[model samples]
Target: MQGFHVLVAGVEPTARQSVPQAFRVSEVVALDAAGLHLLREGDGEPRATGLAPLPCLALFATPKTLPLMREARAWIAAQAAAPVPDVVLLDRKSPPAFVERTLLENLAAANAALAGSALRQARRVARLRAEVEMLGAVRAGLDRFVGETGLAQLKRVFSTATPDFETQIELVHGAPLRQVLPVAGTGFAAIDLACTGGKRRGSFVARLTLLEDGEVLAEWRVPTPAQDGWVRLGLPVAHAGLLRTLCLVVEPASEKSPCANLALGAHQPLPAAQLGDARTGLPIAPHSLAFRLYAAVPGTTPPHSADTLMPVAARKAKPVPYALQALPAEDLARVAETDPGTGGPNLLFVADVAAILCRPGAGGRIRAACPAGARGLMASVGVHADTPSAAVGVLGVDAGAAEPALQRVPVSSGGVEEVSLLFPEPLREARDILLSAEAVDGAAEGAWVVFRDLRIYT
Candidate 1:
């Protein structure tokens, strides 16, 4: 029977054999006083004698053995480490059926409580590990930046540092939002916009474009911010001379939900700076968005163009294959192996490539050293042909930064689709890059999502 374990401490040989048959127990272990003493010691030596560290229920055969069980329970309680097993005294007066029913109920409750505790502990550990890694990445980034550009040369050229906002513009899909501002100085390298009301649901992409004199200077595609704060986008073009007017365009790449709001200041008619929609040719408001512009000091080099800019779609680059079979066993366990509600692998092969299977409530993660000159990640994601429900999978990559590059794709049974996401910054060293996948739909009977052909493109 599929049930929890029970420890029959100091039980007779005949009684020990009957314990498993009396009730639905996966295992019934018998132990003497010496073994009980070993358990109290907490040295884990009882495991060698076929004893589990924690059992759901413990039964004493007679009143004589009750004292030892109580002592062990007290010791465990004092330690405050493991859960104490439910103690039961098996006397001659009690009926066998009643005892059996009570034991089963207790076992179920104990098992549930233990499972919940373990899950909480695991989540805590995972969260702490992520925080530590984030801190380490921040330290590494600061060290690299300061080492390349001296600390004395780093300065903010312009900033609106205001807490009060006149109005807020809600960013939507296909609206073509633009912020026009006149530039009177050179060496501006980056822009930071104050934003609010961004709550991540599935996955969304936000594009930032810079234009001057009707010419495209640089463009960037980043994951929509999951929180409300200042969003920074680095510019790669060199501003060698004074520019007359610069236009900043912010828009959604596609029809995605849950977008951010740009904070705007009070209207000013003299500066000729305003917010408007490029499609309608009408101004939304006669105000400039709250933003900060950063620039490099004289004699210091600006951010490199090749490293910060996203590569063109038509550019030729070699793909470095990352084999799934080479992953360690522990990493493999994090992903779903068997098909949902079935024992099969739910194998799906596309172009002779094996796909990794995932289901609702189950996800996968892969960690590897960042390849030299790596610019982006490419992979194929889809649903199996026999899938019973529709699925949407969100793929993300973290290069040890506060924000991860993200992409959301709908998985269909008809055919596989490919997606490519560029990293925010190019890696200079062999830092670890983490790839993650998870289903975002609310289907209880989730479909089989498959991923294959993962590679790094330079």
Candidate 2:
């Protein structure tokens, strides 16, 4: 019979000694209730180390350790990028034969499930590739006759592209936020903000104000909803002159009001914005509130009417053939929250180029506008030179509308691996791409993952 590894937690030494000889048992110290709570909340220490080649079975020998076992299972689920291990509760009085049989059955089931998932993922990737090829052929035929410019014009006319501008990252919350919009065209009307209401019961009012050059232009007050989601405040601007710059501010009625969470984007210089208490006059540099400006057509039947309201483009257009390291310093500042000691994602230099350094359970989402004719994405993942010889980890890549692609890399000290993933369809618009990493089977401190040279390819 082949030997298998089993992890035993909250099991007495005498009980652990009774594990079947066909299994290699490793003991994990049980975390107390407080410690387990903190771990679940992402504030505690890293997982217990030294058990490598991740075990096939996790056994909890006491009912008191049920919470710990559940926490472990939840952690494994959170690492959606990696393989899952089977967790079981073992009764101290259960027979030896019964325990052995149960372990084997569970191991068999887990392996079967993993195999099925892989098959499905593979089939999905194949279908996506086939569809992409078909689309490419069709586009090529059209381009031969109509030409690239004509084709683009046709797509613009037929495409149901909405002019709604919204940010992808909502990392910051609490306090009031403001956005400064640079005005160009005429017929500016209303603004719709992304807001969620709080649970406290009260007659709180949501105050939205529009200001220009230290003068209040327009203001609207609406009762704060007791529910969640976007709250649209109509800005009734009466000015007919060309407005140079407009500042939009959102806040609660009073301090006793229910706290509302307004979604905010990661800070960027353009579309100048701020978030913090307006009273203190000190802005939080991390976030800018989400807002959508609407304007009526100049020659409309009734100027500034609701029926003529169209979403105005607020954000700057992102460049094509997007490269992660090529982003501006201000944009890259919000890329990842780097803290190596706490296992957060970091930015480091790898082979004389900037790369994203991630510990286990750390990852980030990046938003990019895919250029026309873009078909796939390519990236390089590796381990730092200081990594241990036996370090191993998995990197997961997920493009919009496609199944996630996972690569398991074993770095003997320092090694680099290339990862390429094809989009499910030809991408020509903005989309969010997610990158995650996990320490599959290695020393905790040694399993650092480095990602660099990210490129969207044609």
What lDDT tens digits, residue by residue, belong to model 2 across residues 253-345? 566665445556555554345554443545656455665554433212111222222222222222222222222222223454323445433
As for candidate 2, its clashing pairs are none
Tens digits of per-residue lDDT for model 1, 1-458 = 33444555565544444455544332222234434333322244443232333444544445776766665556545544556665676765556665567666776877798799999999999999999999766754543453232231223556664636336776677676777655544655566676664455222233334454455555655455556566665543335455545667776555745655677866657444667786554677777778776665322233322333332232321222321111222232344322243654433233234356665444445554345556665667777535445566656655565676677777666777877667666656543433333555554354677776554544
Backbone clashes for every candidate come to 0, 0
What is the Å distance of residue 349 in model 2 from its true position? 43
lDDT winner:
1
All candidates: TM-score: 0.32, 0.26
